[model samples]
Target: MKIYDEKHLKNIVLLGAPKAGKTLLAEDMVFEAGIIHRRGTIEGKNTVSDFHDIEQERGNSVFASSMHTEWRDYKINIIDTPGFDDFIGEMIAAVRVADTCVMVINAQHGVEVGTELIWDYIDQFQKPVLFAVNLVDHPRSNFDSALQSLKERFGNAVVQMQYPLNQGESFNAIIDLLKMVMYKFPPEGGKPEKLPIPASEKEKADRLHNELVEKAAENDEKLMEKYFEQGTLDEDEMREGLKLGMIHHEVFPVFVTSAKKNMGTGRMMGFIDNVAPCPAEAKPELSADGQELPIDPSKPAVLFVFKTHLEPNLGRLSFFKVISGEVTTASELVNSQTGAVERIHQLFIVDGKSRNPVDRLVAGDIGATLKLKDTYTNQTLHAKGYDITVQPITFPEPRIRTAVIAFSKNDDEKIGEVLHKIHHEDPTLMVAYSKEIKQLIISGQGELHLAVCKWYLENVYKLHVDFESPRISYRETIRKSANATYRHKKQSGGAGQFGEVHMKVEPYFEGMPEPTEFPVRGKEVIDLEWGGKLVFYNCIVGGVIDARFIPSILKGVMEKMEEGPITGSYVRDVRVMVYDGKMHPVDSNDISFKIAGMMAFKDAFLRCEPQLLEPICDVEIMLPEDVMGEVMGDLQTRRSLIMGMDSKGNYQVIKAKTPLAELDRYSTTLRSLSQGRARFTQTFSEFSSVPFELQQKLSKQLQEVEAV
Candidate 1:
């Protein structure tokens, strides 16, 4: 293995739909570069990526995997990321650190739901993307339709670089458009033979060659002039033009390959080395001291840890991209957040599952280290003088949640420790204890993602976790103002306490949704400023109630509101206007009034609507066009509203909003309906009052479940 400098390193992140042969392609790349002896299959339990046990069992890449390979004298660090939408956070972390993305698509399926989601992430990062049409050997695979679909979706910038010579099972090789030579593979796995253009496909070949040259010429003035004078540019000039266009993003090259047969893998590697942009071609702005810092490979070491892996005995191995300067083993670097310096130990370049020890890594190189004291995922490490936090990988908020309890009480304590370690490994996953349900909650992207994580917990931690469908954190509040009274009298004390509180509960709102704003934080919980102020007018004109006792009653009311009027959830945005009260001067104290306030609030809240507001999530279901109608019907059955529909190629992106409660088992339903061809992503939307008819049914269920 060779280590390249900053200007020569090319970080490429491989993306595609699940089961799109991305891993096979990664294995093929390693084999083609002579890094590995042979290509490994997903079934044989041997592959560069998807090395994790859970991933191999699932037969899919669950997390991003990195491998270093050199192509044509250039070091190409390829990151093989999961294509499933559930593992998008891992892809995001990889994207945050990569210069270009090579999106692979199944030639048979074309642009799939997962591919569309990957495109959404690419758009978010605004990085240049290339398309690789893999598995071209499938019987159903069509070159024209697939290539046209990609061109249409990506705006004609997508031009075919290598055209398949034969279709379907006859697909033997690829025609190198730049060289106008056909590399034909022999039957039963012999070396490919270089042949002249076949007579039968000569006309088609000429047309495709002209299209490629025209596209290439548009990106270069010299090439365009050469084309006009000689009707076509030479191979070297055309390659140079395409290279410039690709690096500048004016052109997106579409390569054809049968990843299973290892066809065209060598050509793809050649393009990646000769054409893809290096670190110097894709330098990003570095922030330092509230300003944009220059990217200098000669200066002090400043690298960002974008990914983390928890190994069995290795502790935590963090993957980072060097932004500036070089890092040698045992060198000291300061963490910008904690301002504490720590020495780098065991600096090594990752080669798939193996680690190659390296003395030093220059800027733009991705390397790993074991067990840093202060550094974690997304932490910035630099040589003392630089103090700036690098931008972290931004992941969407977890929309789905499930409450988990120990299947057996014997594993309760162990669950916490396992969950804590897993959460540190993946920042997207959130773990919390629900006092109401008395269950530990683990929330993430979808049911499948959570299911996979649960499998890891049970298998890896040797603990059982019982999962329950998520319970919406509904809030309870009063509608119209109500006057309530309560009196607490305790005679079991040296000083008998007696207090009476008369208070009105008025509705308060935030940003005027009319009733209340949803995400009310700590301050509003105690002092709700939405409706009217809690006027402690102290109308005890004769001092029947001491000032100390009045504050006590108010405190009690505040405490009750925090516990909610209905369920034990937190209450918000409602004011307790304390108008009048009576108390004995000697017995009355702050504690007495507080008790009075609590009693008064409970009485008033029960009388008002006290309705439960369920959480709704905005969902976008991307499915093939054939299943749009069926999907719409399924959504409507789940009380979902179809906001709108947008079509891209053969897929339909249906945007809808539905209650989170109704979507608990949607993953299963979608799998059955679409035959595992459809997937979706959902996020928490506004919380609306449960509809009148549904409210009664939900209320009954709430009582029944709570009772059980």
Candidate 2:
């Protein structure tokens, strides 16, 4: 391998819908570049990207795989990312470091649900994108329709750079519009023989070539002036203009490829190496302090870890991109977040599962290293004096959740450790123990996401587990004000305990009126642990109760608040005022007052018309318009309030607020309802009261659980 400068290095990520031939295309690229003697197929489970055991068994990419190939004096670092939304974290991490994204669209199916999903993220990162109309050799391939679809979804910026001469069953060659040459490959497909464009297709090729040149010229002033003067751009000028167009996202050149047949991949790689933006040309990354961190080898070394994978026999593999300077073996860097020093023992440029040891990784290069003591994904490693941290990737919140329990008691203790390790491998898979629900909740993008985690735990960790619907985190709150009195009397020893409490409980909100009896002896506003506030008023006048015992009384009220009086859910938004109370001279200690206070608050809470508040989430579902009615009706049954609706390309987005309890298996349900064409995202909104009809049922269930 040769040491290439950042200008000669191209970091590209292959992204698209599943079965769109992304991994296959990557395999073809590597083989064409002579990095591998033979191309590996997904079915054979020998592809470099999908090397994980789970991925091999599933026959799809479960993680992002990094591999590089030297082609035409350029080091092209290719990252093949999983198409499944469940493994979105991998796609996000890869796209974050990539200078250009090659989004592969299935010629047969065109843009799909998965394609749209990944496109949203690509747009979010604002990375330059090139489209590869792949699988053109498939029997049902429709080049015209696929091109039309791309234009419709992504606008007219999608201009053709290459087109298949004979698509589908007889797909043999592609016409390169820029050069006006035809690449005619053999039936078996390898390198192509360059020939002049056929007279029959010359007219259409000329029109497309003009469109490409015009799109390119629009990106640069010099190119625009030259195009105006000469009526067109020459080959070199067009390539330079296209590179500028791509960097500014003013043009997205679409190339044709039959990855399986190994047709047209070489031309695509040439275009990427010659036209795609390099890492230095990419937008400067911002540090945590909002300072621009450019790709400069002269600066102190700063590497950002984007992904972490736990290998079977080997330990953890941390994939990082050198943002500045260079990293070599034995380079000492400090973890930006933890401030722990890490000595780089070795540096390796990854080629699929193979680790190619390199002496140093220069700026803008992606590589992996083993066993960093205190570094993980989204963290930065920098030279000691340089206190810089790259902006972290923001992953989507987990949509589907299930309560997981160990199959055996021994496995119970190990589940936490195993889950932590799994989380390290894929951050999208989240594990949380909900003390309120008394269950360990494991959440992910969808059912398949969680299923894969379960498989890993059982097969890899030998910890069998079962999953069920998770319990919703409902809350309890009062709706009205009420007053109550309680007397605590205990006589067993020399000093008897006696205390009386008179307290008023009322619903509290910001700007609410203060209690009338307050002389302002002591005032404290305690933020509730759950989600609201507790305003405790000390209206003790005339020295009826000592002010020192006020905290003890408030403690008792909080204990009751933790376990609400109506159900066992945590309580919130209630104001308690111990306006008056009786205290015995000898026995009215903290314990007696606390007990009396607890009883009084409980009695008052019961009379105050308590209500159960379930967590509400804002859900945005994107699906084909045909299923809009069905989905909206289904949401209605879940007590959802449809906020609004909008349209995006061929899909409709329905925005609604629904209770989390109603969305237990919504991911799976939505898939089944829309035949897997619908995708959704959810975030926590405000909590709302559960309906009266469901309140009785939940109370009964709580009682049964408590009794058990």
Candidate 3:
């Protein structure tokens, strides 16, 4: 493999909704470059992208696969990403390393919810973008509607560079607005014949061409002046202006393609080679110290790992982009994040699962290396003394969670270890042991995301597992003040245990007045790990309870708080006062006082009307306006509190606060309700009190479990 310089290397990520023909487009692109003789279809499961077994089995992309092709004088590294929201982490990683994003829109559906969701990231990253209106030859393709949707959703920056002369079934020609020529492809669809624009289509083509020229000229002052003086800019001048506009995200160029039929890809690749921004021209990355790090092969080597893949038998493959200098085999670089020296044993430019070994990779190039002991996703490696670290990509938070159980009792520990390995590869899938619930919990984007994880465990690791609803991390607190007394006495042959504790318990709130009636002496405020606070006061007059035994009593209170009397949840936001107590000088010990304190606190807690507090989540749903009624109705049944609503294009945004217990498998239900036209994000909100009846029911269930 030949290593290209930063200026000649172009990295583009294919992004769009599911089933937008991205994998097929990728196959067509590599074929057009003459790297392969024949094209492969998605149905054949032999495409250059989507080579993973899981992706081939599902007939959709699950991981972001990398492939490269040399077109003209430029080497283009293509990252094909999955469209499902569950795999959003893959897309985000690809976009972070890509200089440009190629959003492939399915002409049949126009701008879908998936497209809109991806555009949000594109807009945030502010990278130069271009659109490939693919599948234009399908029977249901509607080119005009798709074009209109782009313009309406994306504003006037959308400039049509080409359009199908005849869409759907008979689509074989495209009128190029930039070249002002018609490309008529052969039935087999490899090379195209250049022909003059016919008289009948000249007027419309001229109108679009002029619009493209104006859009391009607006980016550069000199180009705008030239357009005003000469009536129109020349081809080279227009390309220059468009390139400038693209770098600043001021204009987005659109082209038509039927990737399934192998048409128009070569032309698009040509434009990409000529006009798209390279890494040297794209936005410069910032270091951890806020220093600008430009792509330059002469600087010390610095590489950022954006993705990690663990092969079944082979070791880990770390995918990274060289941010500066050149990386060669056997080059030792310091892991900036770990300070450990790692030698690059090998370097390869990958084409799906097949890796082509190369001696060197220059700056701005994306490649993979195997088995770096200390490196993983989002970490940076650089030469000694550089000490530069690239800003890590911030992944989306998990939207759903569930408790995972191993089918066999002995596999529980093994299951956790395997899941941690999986999480190492895919950061979006988080695994942790919840001590409160006594279960191992796994969280991801949605149900399908977790389903894929289970599939991998069963098939790849030979571990069978099942998923169950995760228990909510509720809290316990009191509502009023009450007093109780407990005496612990156990008399044996020697050393009798006798201790009595008199305590008053009350609800604790921020800035509440100190207990005046009890003559508060010393206060200890504890910040609970779960949530809220615990304030304990030593109110004994003349030391009715010894200061030494006071700590033992507090310890007892803490034990009971850990396992709340009402439910087996953490207790928080309450104040306890040990006003008086009795301790026998000979028999009283730590254990005796501890038992007395625990019993007294528990008795006072039950009498003071303990309440159960449930976890709540802030949910934001985006769906088409027509389906809002049904979605809102479903939310009502879950006891959701609708906060507000807003409008974005033809979609409605609904924000609500809902209890976490009621949101199991909600993403699947929303997809069904909206026919796959809806998307949502969930975040933890403040905890709120559960209803009275629900609290009673939960307490009864806990009692039944204990009896069993």
What's the lDDT for all of these models? Answer: 0.77, 0.89, 0.93
- Model 1 TM-score, all chains together: 0.91
RMSD of each: 4.1, 1.9, 1.1
lDDT of 2 by residue, 1-708 (tens): 577778889999999978899999999999999989988888788988889888988877888999999999999999999887888998999999999999999998787778889988888878899999999999899999999989899997897999997798899989999989999999979899999999999999999899988988898998999999999999999999888878887788999999999999999999998999988888788898788888998999999999998787798899999999999997999999999999999889899989999989999999999998878888999998988989888898898889888878777868988897788667788888888878888889987798889888888777889988877788999899999999999999899998788899999999987666556677789987788999988988888888877888898899888888767889999998888989889988999888889999999999999899999999999998888888999999998999999988767899999999899889888988888878999999999989898998988887887889
Ten contiguous residues with the weakest lDDT in model 3: 646-655
lDDT for predicted candidate 1 compared with the true structure: 0.77
- Ranked candidates, highest TM-score first: 3, 2, 1
Q: Best-fitting candidate, measured by TM-score?
A: 3
The order by descending lDDT is 3, 2, 1
* Ranking 1 against 3 by lDDT, winner: 3
**Highest-lDDT candidate:** 3
The positional error of residue 396 in candidate 2, measured at the CA in angstroms, is: 2.1
